[model samples]
Target chain A: MKSETVSTLLVEAASLLAIGMVFVFLFLALLIAAINLIAAFCRKFPGNFPAESSSVPLTKPLATPSRKIDDTTLAVIGAAVHQYRKQHQSNVKD
Target chain B: MDKFDVLWQSTALAHFTLGQMAMMLVGLLLLYLAIVKKFEPLLLLPIGFGALLTNIPLAGFSQAGGILFYIYEVGIDTGVFPLLIFMGVGAMTDFGALIANPRMLLLGAAAQFGIFATLFGAIALNWVPGFSFSLQDASAIAIIGGADGPTAIFLASKLAPELLGAIAVAAYSYMALVPIIQPPIMKALTTPEERKIEMEQLREVSQREKIIFPIAVLLLTILFLPAATPLVGMFCLGNLMRECGVVERLNKTAQNELINIVTIFLGLAVGSKLSADKFLTVETLGILALGAIAFGIGTATGVLMAKLMSRVSSRKINPLIGAAGVSAVPMAARVVNKVGLEANPHNFLLMHAMGPNVAGVLGSAVAAGVLLALVG
Candidate 1:
């Protein structure tokens, strides 16, 4: 009796394995076709949806230069560069 | 003197049993693995803590009217937490790789053979004395082979609520050990040359295709296998929220805050089932053993299937990515990539592996549905 019950249970489990694996394969196989169809549709009609570029920019444009540098500021900037280069040259020589 | 005696009797120390003490130690071991070893800390930590709470003598944490009891009833018994977790997983998933190469779905389906094969293993155990598993119990145990924690918990809660704790622990612990468990099977099945083969790059998938992919998956699932709709439906909703790009806030919440909250409750609820009466049994040992065998079989089948595909296809396909079909998410995929890299340093298989990795998620969910439909 015990052996009979075990055999029946094993048979049921085997059937389930067959059915489950086949159904999983079939469902996913159909999904593969659906995905391919969707891809083909999107390719045939690219303009149906708005492009991502049309959205508002996510970041603020780095603060634009509104005013030109004055002669005094440029001279100061030039002097700073000269000083830094002189110090670097001295350090390298050392 | 009577007051003193009554007070002493009420203390936990007075009521402690050997079983409770052993279960508490098991809880501490889980905590050690989660904290010290860093094995799936997100779920294991809370699960461990809940185990501690539930096993306290006379605490009644898993009994009627306790917080743990109510949480388990509301979350696990109702089967809400796992579905919610699946939704969050869907929200976080990117099907770009899957879409670029749809053939990988076969690899995903092939991996579920582990789940079904383990069903036979579970039932065969009944021949042993002290081991008698009904069809439902066997089904619940077999899903641990899917290597999906949420799906395992979902099926176990529905089919065999008594085995939920063991199933969940086995599923998650084995998932955490994917790196260790999968490599040997993968290496043994494939040639070193096959591991080194690199495939063509995946094409960029347009956002439009991404938007439709989830809907398509849901449609196919509902039309053919309605039993799987609950898991697949919530998963699609989460994926759609992610891909539609209009629901950024909802998508973010679903993947992040919502998932984290549900995970905590889900872990604790699963832990509540770890009470000594439920956990310290001969069946628990059987479950743990069968769980490992399931994982080994799943990984082996996945690699063998990949080898077969490689032999037939004109394109050179590496067999390592097949192991990713077991669906430990990016972890399985990463292991594949690592193995491939070890064989050939320049050969990167991460993106390729992701194709089948995500498919394995669907595969397991489908397998779960099948088990639910057949056994439940």
Candidate 2:
């Protein structure tokens, strides 16, 4: 359908359409700039940010002062860690 | 008898209406989005393919005893897909923020004002030339404002199966265009200061509370709106699986395999409804118009409700997050976050908006249930 053929209701909305699209384009351009900046910063600080290490499992924090570890509990925890490692390895493979 | 038979020999000829051709092309565009643009490919791709399949002349995929019709009977007409997907959604949702901030429920309710208002608008639009929307059809079209695709389809299948194709397509397409359609509305509704206002850090939520919250909510909704129990029940079940921490297997399946499979079948079944005879009329345009109006009203209501809450409380809330209360999931919430960042880069509204975001999903389902109860 031609733009002129659009109904009066839609024609009234044309101003909104124009204004919304302009803002969207500007937002995209700024997003691209920000991504480029991030890439540059990553290059500048090569090893400073440990993105991968932050998500590592925490086993050492509460255990040393909290309780005496039973063999069964230790085994269960060990099994959980082993499963996590396997899951992680498979994800990396994918 | 032989001479008569020779005179009336049938040759197979595919008959498709102009509207069917248009809808088929639109289906192809959806496929392009799914395959190339990679936009909601999991659901859109299957739906697009289904559209293509069912639109082919004499395919009978949607006819008596056919696969598409059978699937519709099992999943959609019975309202199974929406409830099952709700379960998956509940499993995936984190209700800590919502629990900590109960005020967001009002925003959720405010967003649904769009559904009822659009119902009236859609019914009114029938007065337009060539447009003839029944009460059921208008109600189906109006759910698009709720911005919940599954709920829209669920209600359409039950309340107005004839309009299902238009309603579902409009709902999903608008949802895909949320990032484009919503930011302007969000920006226009709130001032720079309101958008910039940073909320205090949400209080920490315990595992115990997380586990109990779903149960409490389920019980409450069941007692108050037994009509909504079906959806709320499935959702609570899904959440229970996730929070109980013992059903990782079920949780994984619900989120990944079950919802994905149902989405494909559901998409195709919905596409079947878009046959030329049903879709090409002025009613489709009215439906599209009503959908946009519904979304606008929903967004505006959410923002205005948030503004109201701000007046009553000392803790300043960014009214822009209310736009997320229309149940577009993370998409509407993400739009709120993006628009907020535009005004103030430091402001983050994603988690806070999630309270209303998920609530919008529930609210729409309840609204759908109400419509179904009254109109079914």
Candidate 3:
């Protein structure tokens, strides 16, 4: 009776091995097609659906000119640059 | 004298059995491995501690009303912890590599041959007098070949709760040993020229494709094999959250906080099953041996499959990356990269390996679903 049980289990396991491998292969094969189809669709309609703003664009320029700088802003920037250079020069001399 | 006697009888020392002592020693060995060797410390540490707690004489930690009992009941018994872990894994995984190269999915599929082949090994073990595994027990045992800890635990809990501890331990241990276990097989299968082969860079995948990939996977799984939906569904949900570029907070929580919490619970629950009666069996030896074989066969098949692909395709593929198809995640991929570098200093296969690494994850989940459908 015990040997009989083991034999049946071996048979069942053998069948499962065949069925499981085939299904897994078939399922993944279908997934590969589906993925390719999705890729093709996206290629056809690029950026039709933008990712949320949370995604920072990898290639975005570090700075963009949203508006022209005013004269006062430019003067402020020029003064900050002068001050920074003066401090660095003084430290190097020291 | 009477009061002293009562105190003595209540002490753990008084109730200790040889089995409990042996089990506690096993727990300490696990702790040593986790702390000293740092083998999957995240899960092994908690599991080791849980084993100690469960084996303490008169503690009843794994009994009806204990903390370990409740944790096991809430998480592993209900099969929630592994699913939650899968979600977090999904959230953390970047499908870009896979999306860039869909053909790598075949390597992933090829690796799952380990799981099914081990089913035969497990059933054949029944010929031994001490090992009489039911079809379900064999099924649970075979998943260890998947080399995926969560998938193994999930299937083991469902099909053979009694064997969960051995199966989980074997799965994680082999996964940790992938660096050691896979290299020799990888070396034996491929030639030096093949190992040094460099393929073209993967095309940049669009965010739109990433967003659609998980949904397509889930849809196919649901349509054809609803049984696998639980594992595949949660995985897709996590991936969708990651790729959709919305629900950043939810995605972050799933990736970090939620997964960590569940891993702790899952580890402990799995450890609770390591009590004396459940663990001290001849069957555990069979399980550990079988788990190692599963990994070896899976690695061999993956490498062989890649060799076949390399032969057919105009573009060359380094057969080493095929070993990553067993889904030890970045670890398996890194091993492939390291081996490839040895053959040719200029070759870098990390990104290429990641495609099959992640594919192996889905492949194992699908395989688990098949086992469940057929045997459960």
Candidate 4:
């Protein structure tokens, strides 16, 4: 009706929007902080999930076992070791 | 002169002259970039073809109720095309990395500073001859900084439909060139040591968090930015289809068929706007220059924010990854990884950089909302 009344309504609407925005910002800031907190926890202790736990035991099997050597192969290894030890002993004595 | 005039008059059925033929060759070059170079082939191919059609003088492709014209009306003019494309992007995007590293949100938000900065650059460009851009038009054109095609198309649809072709072209072109444009700035900003900073392995984001994120973001949009919800809502819808794990059919269709189909229509619609009278102008050059400035500013802001957080966190964050904050998705992330490898062959920042890359997508959509609110 009157210009003053319309202006008053407009002012009220603006204020409402501002207040609404502030609240939205605060809520989002908190939610983001919460997500960051959870992600930080997850990073520190990852295998709490079953999937992450499954990936860990995979690399453990790579440690090869000690095996008995063939006679010829063992003789070659022993001769090479003997030569290496003799050189080390000479160097140490010097 | 008389002989030449007689010969020219004798040349009937000659629809295209030499200059028009050259422009057509330029269109062919763009097509090569699309098909062979794979520079966003889905859009670029259609756009290059449309450019050729529009420049053909008497081609009825741009006339009333023509295919391109109808597509423009149904999609681009109504702003539905970009929104639908956002759905595909959301379905394809992985927010897991950003969720794993929440602090990357800061980088994502910081990257938007360039968007606003270029708005000013666009307005100031009006001081030059043959370039006249209003504030709203400048705001619309400057969104190419996001490097997101749909967002560029979205804003242009609202503020400057006449400028859509240029904005979309700049956005997609720079996107394809992110590998070229970003590395120098990233290298200049950080030392070899900073680039070599090995990021800790990203923690796995849970299925629950992954599923909830899109919903949360959609709710946030509903509350904070209703103007952006049309684009963001469809985006979340597509992401929900993906993350829910039950809608494999919808996810497949949205990501593959629906998106590809819409991209052709959208590109053709946008390309149809590239008539010589509308496109070959000083204003288009201004838009291109402003887009570059927008992209540069967005990149610089991301790096600066990353640097700031590094001090605050007491652990090093690779500032190079921050350059991915311009919404180029995997391309920006790949660029970060590539540049990081140049510094230290050991470092792999692709997955880590993806956090800001995707988050920047959301940030730019939010920026688009702000523009719609302020301008619409």
Best-fitting candidate, scored by lDDT: 1
* Second chain TM-score for model 1: 0.99
What is the per-residue lDDT of model 1 for residues B50-92, given as tens digits with 9 covering 90 to 100?
Answer: 9999999888998898999999999999999999999999999
TM-score per candidate, in order?
0.92, 0.76, 0.94, 0.79
Clashes within 3 Å, all models in order? 0, 0, 0, 0
Please give the ranking of all candidate structures by DockQ, highest first, separated by commas: 3, 1, 4, 2
Candidate 1: fraction of native contacts reproduced: 0.72
Candidate 1 lDDT tens digits, A1-94 = 2878999999999999999999999988988899899989988988657446324344548996758999999999999999999999999999
lDDT (C-alpha) at residue B261 in model 3: 90
* iRMSD, model 1, in Å: 2.5
Instruction: Report the lDDT tens digits of candidate 2 across residue range A1-94.
Output: 3323334434323333343223322322332343334445544655533233323443356645646889999999999999999999999999
In model 2, how many backbone clashes occur?
Answer: 0
Inter-residue clash pairs, candidate 4: none
What TM-score does structure 3 among the candidates reach? 0.94
Give the root-mean-square deviation of each candidate in angstroms: 3.7, 13.9, 3.2, 10.4
Taking the tens digit of each residue's C-alpha lDDT, what string does model 4 give over A2-55?
445444534443443344334333444554786766556655765533333312
How would you encode candidate 2's per-residue C-alpha lDDT over B1-376 as one tens digit per residue?
9876654443213366666678789789989987887777766777787777777665677788678878878888888987788788788877767766766766776788788777766655644556655656766887898898878887887788888888888898788888878777777888888899888777655455556667766765565457667877888888877766656678778878887777778777777676777877777888888888889988998898888888788988889888998889889998888888888898898898997897787677667666665555
Model 1 residue runs over 4 Å out of place are A48-50, A53-94
Better of 3 and 4 by TM-score: 3
Which lDDT tens digits does candidate 4 get at residues B31-119? 99999999988788999898787667556677885677788899988888888899998899878888888778767777877777777
Which has the greatest DockQ?
3
After superposition, the stretches of candidate 4 with alpha carbons farther than 4 Å from their true spots are A1-31, A34-94, B1-23
